[model samples]
Target: MSSSELVRVGIQIICEHLIEVLKEELKRSRKNYREDVDVGGLDPLEDPESYRNHLRMSENQFEELYEKVKSKIEKQNTIMREALPSRLKLQITLRYLATGDTYGTLEALYRVPRCSIGRFVPEVCKAIWEVLEEYIKVSRTNLLNNIYLVHSLT
Candidate 1:
């Protein structure tokens, strides 16, 4: 090749190599996110006493309810990350209901963002209500039937 042609090809090769190196550096920098927010540590529901105190439900009840509603409440895991566990979401919702605490209080305890807790509370409650609706309706029907039976006999 001519001298000028060779120099042009070398510069082009160097530019391509530099672009690849820059892309890799970008990937590394993205992975090294400087997250200051505390997150995902020490679930209170793991302890039986704390579970009952905070949720007003036994662990078994929590598990049963969680199982029923898990599919409804679960979120899709993306390239970003997996969503919070269904158990934790339910615990947060129950704690809010029991104590009427603000999202700030829940955020401190759960290590989730107050904004996220605000979104999660209503979504989780709706999931729980959807799962429990049948049982609630059945109980109401049984109670009304007993009342009708008593009145009819009189």
Candidate 2:
């Protein structure tokens, strides 16, 4: 081969090796930051009032909702990383709904990437709605009745 051809081949091999190394470094760094952060330290579930204020629901309510939707929203762990827990997924979704916080804010607070939060929020919300659609319709009817009764009394 010509010397120019040999040099080009050597550069291509080096570029391929560098890309592999960078991929490994990226994977290692990702594992270090997100999944390693101790979300349990926040422990919002430990305080019933705080949990209600933050998530707009009591712990019992959260648990009931979680139980109903867990099968749909729960993810399996994989070789690359552990899946976010079903309870955490529900909590995050509820917090988002309660606060209307941006995904960037949630990522900072929750130690989950905004991209993952964006992806999971819709999935969890769908699961919750699927599980609770009938309950919500009934609650709406009851609420309308209560409003009418109050107006009648006044």
Candidate 3:
């Protein structure tokens, strides 16, 4: 074969290997999302009230927060490939906050890898904070005035 043809063949082989690796990764992610015992066993949709114990949010509150933060937390499938569902992302974050659990513990509960859990927790938290910023942020005037008063007293 010509040198150029050999190079093409080499590229093709590399592409095939990458494709196989991506396919396997996708399969494992899909399995983790679908068949994870904790994900299935928790069944937040089936018993949202019971889920409250774990997430510290009632069904209505969870839905409200989910809707508010959905745009921020939602991931495009093309880039994220096996993106966690918005609901699942919120659940995992809330569970972490409620329980003060490590990512390792969350990995066992949510079946997402600890590395992914680490990323998702922060992403979801930032999204939630953004969604609630209007309600959560203190008035700068009030905050500054209080600080000034405290400093003056000191």
Candidate 4:
């Protein structure tokens, strides 16, 4: 393959690897949901009746993210079919990662255990962080840079 194609392939693999890592990280959390779980209601999306907010650039940005993630998800699904054996596992996991729903709500919405969602979310988030750790780290350099910038502006 060409260098550009290799880069594209590497990016694709990184995304798939990120999702897998996130799922594994989610598995390491030990929290369980009890009947008294105290999650609040949804902070509703700010789209208005007249669709003004929907017309914003953020919507298009989100749409692009959705497409990229969805394609990566599809590729991962094919690779994982033999191992996972259940088609819904990935979809449910993605929903848990993308949407900050409580275990109870996810259970009701996706027919999975509240305990499962509670246990899974952090794992996935950790995995994503792990994949991008070098790039995403809150480094001393970044903090110092930000501090300097703030002081200069003030």
Pick the TM-score winner: 1
**Candidate 1 TM-score to native:** 0.67
Clashing pairs in 3: none
Query: Which should have the higher TM-score, number 2 or number 4?
Result: 2
**When superposed on Cα atoms, how far off is each prediction in RMSD?**
10.5, 8.4, 8.6, 20.8
TM-score for each model: 0.67, 0.63, 0.61, 0.30
The candidate, 3 or 4, that scores higher on lDDT is 3
Model 1 lDDT per residue over 1-154, tens place? 9999999999999999999999988766655543443465335447878767777888788778889988988886543445676767878778777887777787888888777776677677667666787766556566546534532332
Candidate 3 CA-lDDT value: 0.73
Once superposed on the true structure, which residue ranges of model 1 sit more than 4 Å away at CA?
A: 1-15, 22-38, 41-46, 137-154
Q: Which stretches of candidate 4 lie over 4 Å from their true place?
A: 1-94, 137-154
* Residue pairs whose backbone atoms clash in candidate 1: none
Better of 2 and 3 by TM-score: 2
RMSD of 2: 8.4
Error of 1 at 54 (Å): 1.2
Residue 71 displacement (Å), model 3: 0.8
* Poorly placed runs, candidate 2 (over 4 Å): 1-35, 40-45, 138-154
Tell me how candidate 1 scores on lDDT: 0.71
Model 3 per-residue lDDT at 44: 70
